[model samples]
Target: MNFRACFVLLAALVCLASPALAKTPVIGVNQFVEHPALDAILKGFQDDLKENGVVVEYKVYNAQGNVSTTNQIANQITDDDPVLVLAIATPSAQAQVAATRKNAHMAEVPIIFSGITDPIGAGLVTNLEQPTANVTGVSNQMPMDKHVAMIKRFMPDMKALGVLYNAGEANSVSNVRRLKAAAEAQGIELIEATVANSSEVTQAAKSLVGKVQAMYVPTDNTVVSNIETVVKVAEESKTPFFCADTDSVRRGAIAAVGLDYYEHGKQTGEMARRILAGAKPQDTPVEFQKTLQFYFNPKAAQRMGLQVPQEIVESADVIIGE
Candidate 1:
């Protein structure tokens, strides 16, 4: 073959390999559902990477609030051979961890997670400093005591607080336990209701209708998605509702003081950048995000015949119309 023809062929091959040669990486993001909370997180993650000059192709996997779908999406994302992966919620993160543990293909891919309230309680890692596994990530952990405090502010004479959680979710279990402890410490009683899925939420809520003076809604995905039913039951019975997720406040809860999951996503991206830059997963510290925000819905408060205190109203980051 002539030298000129051989040189031309070599140039074409190099051009074709340019993507692999580039320092920028392809990142896979797994979102549990299309809920407003998780969608904000996806936006923050994408925005951070774009600003940092990192070439990232993100695939948002919506589990549609199904654990089975979360597992399936995790498997599909792992097959794409991304440099790293980001799981948006607790279920999605757990599903990704399960897929990576069982397989050899994604064994080396670093994982970052956001919107998870309790990474350790969920079995995602052994320690906060070092993950001791292929996965390390950020947590949108809300302060349980602070949440109860906010609840008390609205209902100064509050007692017999009802809490709804998904018994199957470790994160929910952890949060509920904290809620129980906090309620006891404040001289308030806790009424517990465990719902397996969205289908059972309304019935579970009805059980709490006349028994509890107020309801505490934690960051349970199942209950969060089915909040309208809970709201319907609670409002009709003059039972006040409180929440731990900011989105829940928008969805009709009386108030919320919790982690900003979207900011938590940007925090996740910072760790992801470090992992992609050759740091081991264990070397990076797992972060518990501290950006808690408060939202109060005066309409819901009025519906329950409750008046929020002046100081508590001033503490709100966002206030809804009454």
Candidate 2:
């Protein structure tokens, strides 16, 4: 226990304090459900972070489309004390925001939410231009007018338009309002069926059969998590089901005019990178997709005994099944 021993301890402490030797920063990613769109967003976020030179260790958790489980995951993530939290969907974001409020340590943890359609309506932010809160991220809000127009374009005789969504998702609820307005303006009746979880999606879709001419799905995580159920119902009912997410078109929806969830995730990751680089969430305005894509499934159209309009087929950005 002489000068050499004392010097060795001092050198170890210096190394521990050095930024180069510090442990990789950890980020918590809480996803509400395991759906293709949300999964793509998660992938885009991680990929973008890697591409942007941000080295982060992530603790990913899935809620499996359960609200209670979502809250539990959020609480666990809060307890882990990650540098930042990325909530994938509206419900997950709401749960994480509530959990952080309950945990004093997590209250300061910056949150970035992706795949949310209505940040302001969901109370996730005070304003889109100025968040004024510790939570800010990308919104996957598609244009409802364009969606309604696309449906009408395909089925010129469409009278009643069906909508199946989760009443619990704020984003879906907000989009439903827009859809209703659009329907009213187009002189089309809007038939609504709400589901609380993925298991109810098929029943909800079935309820729309014969009651409406076609079905339009909002960007609701619950409904999209079980999109195949809705698709099966639509196919059996011979009702063309349209979606607000492009990824859903590939999964069997007849068509969609919207942005890709992967792109939404990349935008979310870029915002997270800004947050990590000392940009406060309160100062960063919420971002939205600037471009949209048209996707259609000709197989789905034929299954429903409908013919894709020549104009729509020509204008589609991506056509499934040729």
Candidate 3:
């Protein structure tokens, strides 16, 4: 072959072999912690995107339960200039939103959040229907009334309910306020215990020992991350522990009627795909997980010295430790 022909062949080989030569989309993920539910959400999101042919170069940053670290991670992600940012929890979402607001370039990068209970209260978005900004995603908001009603079904004559949550988490704080109102409306007293971190969760659960008839856990990232500690205390105290996250049911909560984090992530992934396909985040309305899942643990109930109700067991979508 002539020199020119040989050079042309080499150029074609380089184009085919060098992935770096092609423009691959980059997606930045900011995760609050390595909890089961949040991990499930990330898995679902990635699986959905892969199925939908959305191949993205991922840069995942974990805050590891440090709320302050989220701010630093957000700043680092901003520097990466990814095509989009996926914030996995409330703290992660808030950090990315704050970073976006401060940096002009970051402001243009769309952010999609999952596992956030109260986006408006967190100040991540102005409106749920129309975000009016470059941010919109899924909200894992469970029905407070329904959760209270389920607790009533288990402990019909219960007078007081205990709750453990992270006071610093906006999602937990907002959910606790709603739960308090719901409890009051039902004439049930609520006992609250706040924990700053996972290490303090056991002490927080112990504080509620005789105060509440049953213990309820909200979708607090911090509290849920160390749920086994709370569960161990509740089991020893013979208090039926309920959760607002279905995955916690498997983690030893007596039961839960809640959203599935995997499904929540899948929905959030779809939204991200839409954003990648030229849909504006501001125009895309925020979505809520449509299906409510029932998860009951017979072993947990038995450990709490409570028998699993036949009707509840029959109706549960998943029965852990059957």
Candidate 4:
């Protein structure tokens, strides 16, 4: 073959053998801690995006239940200038919002949050219907009235209910406040034991042992990260332990009427899809989990010195530890 022919043939081979130079969008994720519910949410988020043909790269970060570390992670994510940010919990979401606001370069990067109990109360957004900013996501806010009624179902004659949570988490604080009002309306006194961090959770749970008939845990990252400790305390004390997330029921809580966090993450993922497809976060309304699921663990109930109600067993969406 002539030199010209060989050159053309080499060019063709290079074009065929070389990889495509398509740029995949990068998505930064800041998860506050590692737990069953939050892990499920991240899974659902990734699966939904994949199923919907939203090809992207992920830069995942876990704060491991540290507020300062969450802030640092958020700043690092901002510096990465990802196409978007997915904040898993209230603290992570708040940190991302703060970091983005401080860095003008990331001002346009949209943030979608999941597993947040109270977005408005967390200061993530001012209005749910009209976000009016570059932040909007899903709220896993449990129905306070329904939750109170559910708790009452297990302890009909209970005069007091104990709650353990981290007072610093805006979502937990909001949940506890609403729970208190609902409990009071039902003539049940709310006994609160606030913990500043996960290490303090066991002691906090012990404090409420005899003072209350049963113990409850909100969707607090700090409390949920160290849930087994609380479970141990409740099991030894014969105090029925309850949770606000269905995943916790499997982890040892007696029962819960809570959102399916996987579905909640998918909802947030849909919002993210829209944002990536040219929808402004300011125009997109914040979403909430549409369906709530009832879950129970018979063995957990037994360990906490309680029996699973027949009605609850029959009606539970998920019945584990049978």
Candidate 5:
């Protein structure tokens, strides 16, 4: 080919690829757990944002359940000066908030959080529908009304419900309130048993012995970090327990009808994409998942001597190995 023609062809190719060559929207993700529901949320968030034409460059960071480490990691995250951040869980979300709050210059960097039960209660925002600041995102905080429905499906005769949660966490408090309301609406008595820290889960679970018909474990950071202890106690007591997260179901809980946390991440990703597309976080309304998931553990059911209806089991996207 002639030199001029070759040059023209090459120029055309570069011009055509301009949009694809654009710098990806740099985003930092802070996560405290590597569980399935949360993983699903992240996967969905990434896929949705990328599919929407956002060029996102992701740097996934794990906080390892240490608030101090999470805070430190968030500080390091800001060093990259990412255009946006996705905080996966409560601690991760708070870490992002702390990092942004600690530095005035980076205040404009918008954060979209997922898996946070109560953004306002957690002091992340002033309101849900209309965030009055440079932050907004989706929440995988399981709906209490839905948990009530799940309970009825599993144990039609269940009259009393017990909840174990971390009393200090805003998300746990929000969940417990909603859970109590759901139990009330369903005409069931609700019992409260709480732990102050990871070391207190066994004692907390033991406290619920014979006082409640069934137990509901909220997606509290403290309880989740120590699920095995609670599981062991419940197993020994033969008390049927339900988790607020799918991961808990997989690990041991009989079942959980809750938000698919990872999908929550994907949903958050969509929100982040919108902000990256020039939509201000303050202008964008808080997003909620339109769908929920039911994760059941056949093994947990068998061990607890609980009979989960086959229909419900069949409906589960996940049935942990018995």
Candidate 6:
């Protein structure tokens, strides 16, 4: 070969091997379902990375509130071999964890989860301070005591409380157990309504009417994904509707004492950043949202045949619909 041709080949090889020309890291996001709260969590995670100047490409997937679909997405994500995986809800996290464990190559990839209520109970990790496996992220566990108290404050004469959830979701089941205990301690009967999917949510909400004075919904992906149906049922029946996340208050729930899901996502993202910067998921402790926000909607309360207590109105962190 000529000298000029030899020099040109070497230069081209160097350019191809340059770090600046490397492909962006891929983050696989497996969300259990599409809901305002879960969606906010994803937005916060991406925004945090962008704000910190971390550039990467995202491969996002939604389960559409189906368990089989979540498992399918998990397998696809494992095959994709992304740098990291972010599971938005408990089911998605569980599926990803299982899929990665079965694959030798994907097991090493970090899995970060957000919008989960009970990480320990969900079997994501045995220890919070030091995870026993390659899975750690934020837990948006709502205080059941505070939630029950808030419901009581809104309805002093409440004799029975209704809960709408999906039995398939580990996080929702965990929340229901906590909520049942809390309600029982307050001398309130807890009525349970379980649904298999979003299509069943309307009937579940309808069944609660006339049986309970107030209705409460946990951060169940299936139920929360179809929150408007419950809202309509509550409004028509004048049954007070409460939720476990702040985002639901804007969707016509009377009140909620829960985490700002967007902020919860940011917290999860911060943990992911650490993991990407050489922090192992097993070494990283599970984090919780430090600050909780109380949200109330006076217009929603009126529709539900209730008057917002002045104390709650004054103490709420956010007041929806004025």
Q: Please identify which of the two predictions, 4 or 6, would achieve the higher lDDT against the true structure.
A: 6
Better candidate number, 3 or 4, judged by TM-score: 3
TM-score of 6: 0.93
| lDDT (Cα, tens digit) per residue for candidate 4, span 18-113 | 746445689999999999999989999999999999999999999999999999999999877799999999999999999999999888899998
TM-score of each: 0.91, 0.93, 0.94, 0.93, 0.83, 0.93
Per residue, candidate 2 scores C-alpha lDDT tens digits across 1-322 of 8999999998789878896875778999999889889999999999999998999999999999888999999989987779999999988999999898888887678999998889988888988988856899998887788889999999888899999998988999999999999988998999999998777888889989999999989888888878889889988889889999888899999999988878888888899999999999989999989899999899989888788768889999999877
Error of 3 at 46 (Å): 0.5
What is the RMSD, in Å, between candidate 5 and the native fold over all Cα?
5.6
Off by over 4 Å in 1: 1-13, 16-25
Residue pairs clashing, model 1: none
Model 1 scores worst on lDDT over the 10 consecutive residues at 19-28
**lDDT of candidate 6 over 1-322, digit per residue (tens):** 9999999998778779896765678999999999899999999999999999999999999999889999999999988869999999999999999998999999789999998889999999999999867899999887898899988888888999999999999999999999999999999999999999888999999999999999999989889888999999999999999999788899989889988888888888888999999999999999888787889999999988887768878998889966
lDDT of 4 at 309: 69
Of 1 and 5, the candidate ranking higher by TM-score: 1
CA-lDDT, candidates in order: 0.84, 0.89, 0.92, 0.91, 0.81, 0.91
C-alpha displacement of 73 in model 5, angstroms? 2.3
Which residue runs of candidate 2 sit more than 4 Å off their true CA positions? Answer: 1-13, 16-21
Lowest lDDT block of 10, candidate 3: 15-24
What candidate 4 gets wrong by more than 4 Å, as runs, is: 1-21
Report the Cα lDDT for residue 243, model 1. Answer: 86
Task: Give, for candidate 5, the lowest lDDT window spanning 10 residues.
Answer: 19-28
**Candidate order (lDDT):** 3, 6, 4, 2, 1, 5
Instruction: Give candidate 3's TM-score.
Output: 0.94
Cα lDDT of model 5 by residue, 173-248, tens digit: 8989988888899899999988876788899888997998788888787788678888898899999888887788
Cα miss at 316, model 3 (Å)?
1.0
Which residue runs does candidate 5 get wrong by more than 4 Å?
1-25, 49-56, 309-322
